[model samples]
Target chain A: MIVIGSESRGSVPNTSPNVRDMAQVSCCQLDEEEFRKCCLQLLQRSEELRDGWSWQQPQGSEDGYLKKTTLRCVSVTSKRSKKNQQDSALLIDSDCRQNQSAHVSAAPEEATDDADDEDVADDADVPACSACESSFLQFEYHVVFSCSYSSPVLYFRAFTLEGRSLTLEEVWSSIHPNFRLHLQENPLNAVSQQEHPLLGQPFFLLHPCRTEEFMKPLLQMAQQHHRSVNYVLSWLSIIGPVVGLHVPLQYFSTVCVKDPASSSNPG
Target chain B: MIMNNDKDVLRDVWFGRIPSCFTLNSDEVTEREAEPYYLMLPRVSYLTLVTDKVKKHFLKAMRTDEVEEMWFEYEGTPLKWHYPIGVLFDLHASASALPWSIIVHFKSFPDRDLLHCPTNSVIEAHFMSSIKEADVLKHKSQVVNDMQKKDHKQLWMGLQNDKFDQFWAMNRKLMEYSTEEGGFRYIPFRIYQTTGDKPFIQKLFRPVSPQGNPHTLCDLLKEMYPAALTNDGEQKRYQVLIHGIEPLLETPLQWLSEHLSHPDNFLHICIVPVPTD
Candidate 1:
């Protein structure tokens, strides 16, 4: 029973004015300026993340204005759920072949077996035979700051190697079952295709209205422990996995350094 | 009397109409030439929610196999169905000749440019999400969170059915604020500009200043978008529009948020270049 957004604000125990001011400074939410600074820091550190993600500012915009960070063509593998497999067999058999061929060039070893199975299972109960097998998917992820919510939002879209976009149902099927169950329970956290605010392109985004609700506890815990955590990294670690964008452990090790203020506290 | 004036402004904003002509894209393979569909689009309503007639009108001349999810484009740019009709018109075609000529497509739905509104339920969900977001800004979600499921539904139904009284019955509660607090915690608004690829400008702007003076629209523009305002003696380059009309710069932000906000409860302001001619 997770209360979302400002509804949960009243339930939390009241803190002293000093603590409240601390919470305001160390709160999970970021203003546009803080979001931009954190994004620049994330790009500067984390060499691996840097390879995948790039900051994109719209042309003819002044410096220090709105910009989106993008990570493109991240490959993911997920075992197709039984229902999705059945639907794919009936609806996209030919499309699967084209995608499989494209995947072969990208990953020859894994795609070969899957491609062979897809060819044979065209008329069979493919779900039963290839239940354990996985499908290769390419996903593009964008981290855009939502001004209304004052939070960074994850907008991503999954596509086949052949370039056909996955519908929302197909995306839901690809989610890790653990996160999928949680997302299913909370309708606000559900992923839906929305127009990319900057590009005006259609991309699937997890609703950001409740981001502060979910991130608050994690941030509060860190604040209490005197751990200075990167807002973008911590926030991304929570949400990235839901959409199959796993944050690498190297990111934490490489980028996060203890703050000088927190250094006085003994481990 | 102030309440009466506010009610009148809300009604005018709700009932504002843009007469539009939706023409089928010339490239669409049709059994017969499709006639251009014409309708007076409700300013506060979503394009996809209100364009069923336009879809049906064009579908008559097209083969069932050739039709895909219907999409609308103005000039060359694909119109996002998620935005309110008035926002789209004001941003792209404000100074254009009327009835606004919109190109409709049945094939090759631009997957990149537009979100798919497969059913009215999608629009409902989007609409409800927007109202909740606005409430989060206005009352810290207190007013809307206190609402029952039916109250939420009534708000949606009112907008969907175009029943002004039914909507205001549920909506007036959302627009409420304690007199001691002056107005909403923050004014829920989005400033749209036609020039850039940037979607829109949104930030936490309060209706009243810290000193308790009521902030005007000019104050918001000055803080969020200084360029939209002309410097002393400079030629006016932009026209700031809300519901196809420009309110005075001196209008209080709180009054505008209450009266001019769409059913979703966000004051959508569009800044379009003034006609050079």
Candidate 2:
């Protein structure tokens, strides 16, 4: 089941090896709606608690074993990028104002998840020599979408204040230090350059499968404890870094998520 | 599959070897009670094949008048009669060119003193002395002619001292031979470990590479888990213990072979998460 390398010997042409491994797990028997329902149910409670991440239910027929849930972490844009965004933003103010409705649904945590998609459709229309002066470009939309197979695959793209798509290479270079560990070794998973299956756009797929072995115990702990103490926050703290999604560690002080299993013991 | 060669069981660690059953207090038994007859068995015994129906051919070969039922012990655990002899060595000892120094205990002598066998310390001493004796064979057959005075003194001194630490540090070099001696001159040794509770077997390389670069037990962890190299992941490094003592990551594998690597039990790979403090 070699997936990413030159020798991709997976039996299904579209199915990757990671997805196949996920399919082989005992949890694969769970249907798409139930799968999405279970994961979102956990995060939905966390969201009500204002946990580090926000969840979105799948929109259409793209679910497999579960209605793939989406997790997003919003980060503020760098000051320099903000300045550049503002300069270019005024030039395209008309377009930026047109998509204010879509921007409202972005990062609920930041209360400031900025950016109006001024030019979401066209990459070629913008001139090369000019600077991007989009005024509202202050948010980084980091999202990971789950698959029907219960595998969490990434779907991410960043935009400027004027709504210009940031190059996948830019996102690669700007990966958080906590997430840099994966990028430094066999970095192909760092920013896997692939076309978004749904958006029909080029985007980086931060592979979460690398941590498959690392997360098994966490999942087992969740099940063995009957219910996690704070399963959603614990899950995001462990997984958010793998895909370059920045969920601040400060929110999870003692990391009591692993407590679910340890809590089972009376001793 | 049944294999006659003990080396095959010794080195093929991917599947892991079944452990030896011999249980006892110490590795070497210095004193022994005289049995009816002292029978020196073959250096290596691997009789898994069955004859006609119920009789085992290999065990039958080692039979004597008083040898009602032959068995061996380590520490104090009794070796199982059902398993083959080759696998017994594989379970207890590292793969080596040197023949095993084991004693055959007959069941007939119930109340008498048992036959003594080589312990880890005794095995280590025998190998050290054997190499010294062989050194005399080189440079010329005239004993001690090829062996220099300094080399001769160090060998006997290390042997008599019974200081496993320093003796093995010096002798592992003798165990290795370059291409000049011929291809494949090193002893094949392996250790087993489990990551957390997930048990898996993996091969540990000799401390020195063919080019002579020093390697460590840490190297074994690195080759197995590439993620261990990172700052955040470095904490995932395995903690190896031969008995209960944790061997230092910097210590050479050859030293472990002499002092800690036991034939009776597999080495444990201890997994403990890095303390945040």
Candidate 3:
């Protein structure tokens, strides 16, 4: 098409409308180093439940009867999936959570190098795996279910989470009947002495890194553009052919469906 | 142009051809963590180009060695010539996606050593006017060859699956349904390959395949230059070297002319006729 040099002031020929729209959208550039610092700052501000995990104040409940707390899965992914879809949940050991709490309470300025030893592969070419030697295709998605060393019951629904919208029943059905997901963040339950106490049943471990600073703008971009994070990723991927060159960016968003149960439905 | 002494030796070293690892910066590493070689060392490869008019002026300015000291603005920010080489490389690489930067010089040429010299080396001359007709005939032969190579069912399946679409599309009529048949005659630039003093017309038009294999570009170039070419009176004396020749409705003819003016930027390698004492 005779696309020459860096600056030609015309519409690129053969360019799709969706691709051109994405090229115009701007995104925040976050490197691995910046991500690490943001994560560490969040951990220090909240109460650490263990080495890599932390909890914040259990806020007022949505229904007034159910209190909600925020769990920051640092270097850890909260197994937030149903039992059948249990591979997606965050599995935190009790000792790890206790250690996390102790560390958070200490108010240590020195961030530990070994806080939650989970490795997340940020590249599409490479897949995240438990072991380094596994093939790229061999890696499987894991889910976090409620505490069961035996018949592992999963409560977090994975399907509804895909586009970020779900009904209260969808969330309720996904949760184990024994464990109620309290909106409160206090690891120490004030009503621990109550009969038929909820223990071992896992609540969805929401990521603590959600300051809205990173996501709010991304959501705005997606909404204003009528696109999804998946759509953006797909859009960015096509930039190679546009100018007849390859340009890679660090920041990208994933199209997410909020648990209609959670009320942040993207759709 | 005079970054280092012994220009002849440097030219010869390039002519010998080092491995692609040392030259092009495309070696496979164990973990894709950091490209140590690309990050640390300068990947020096001979980017052979034929110059036009305006580019020749810029080259002359660069050779005066004053551009290296001049404080010029890039993207509105004033940057000096001696800023890290990485900065220029990075910006250019990223800017590849963006439109080409229009260089508007407000000042005069630099006052350094005049080491820059223009050679009368020949480069490939792709006559954009002839490509459409030639491509049509070439594809017809290719289709005949493919039929002989494969059975009827396989050929039908390949066509149905859009496998041969690019090949056919390249040779197809662009204005088939238009009232003005042959409204846009697809003419490609004549590409010339130059080595030392002599320039040769390139036989292969497209360096890359539709499947995106970069190695194929190298392979095509290698196939075109099977043996080392020496520049002598008996060999071919090529005409003016040009860049970005692919014929379109509007030609950025100035770009080629601008690049040709600068002798330093486009070093025309020519064998010395006499050994100076």
Q: Which candidate is the best by TM-score?
A: 1
Q: How well does chain A score by TM in each candidate?
A: 0.61, 0.48, 0.23
The window of 10 residues in a row where model 3 chain A has the poorest summed lDDT is A145-154
Docking class of 2: incorrect
1 or 2: which has the higher lDDT?
Answer: 1
Per-residue alpha-carbon lDDT of model 2 for B4-86, expressed as tens digits? Answer: 46334323321222232211123222233222222222112222111111123223433243233344553333433222233
* Candidate 1 chain B lDDT trough over 10 residues, lowest sum: B176-185
Q: Estimate TM-scores for all models.
A: 0.80, 0.29, 0.17
User: In model 2, what lDDT does residue A63 have?
Assistant: 27
lDDT score at residue B147, model 3, on the 0-100 scale? 38
Taking the candidates in order, what DockQ does each have?
0.26, 0.01, 0.01
Give lDDT tens digits, candidate 3, residues A1-267.
221121223543432211112122124333223333333332332212222322221122110011111112112324555432533433222111111111121211112224422221122223233432221111001111111010011112111111122222333333232333442232221011100102211122222122123344764787798764432222223321121111123222211332113221111
**Chain A, model 2: TM:** 0.48
> Which lDDT tens digits does candidate 2 get at residues A224-245?
8875334333445566554434
Better of 1 and 3 by lDDT: 1
Q: Write the per-residue lDDT of candidate 1 for residues A1-267, one digit (tens) a residue.
A: 111122234443342111111112325668777777666656655433444455666676532322222222322334455533532421121112112112112222332365556533441322222322334445666788776677888888765534567787677766667777877885665888887777666888898877888889988998999977777778888898776565667767856562323211111
| Fnat for each predicted structure, in order | 0.43, 0.00, 0.00
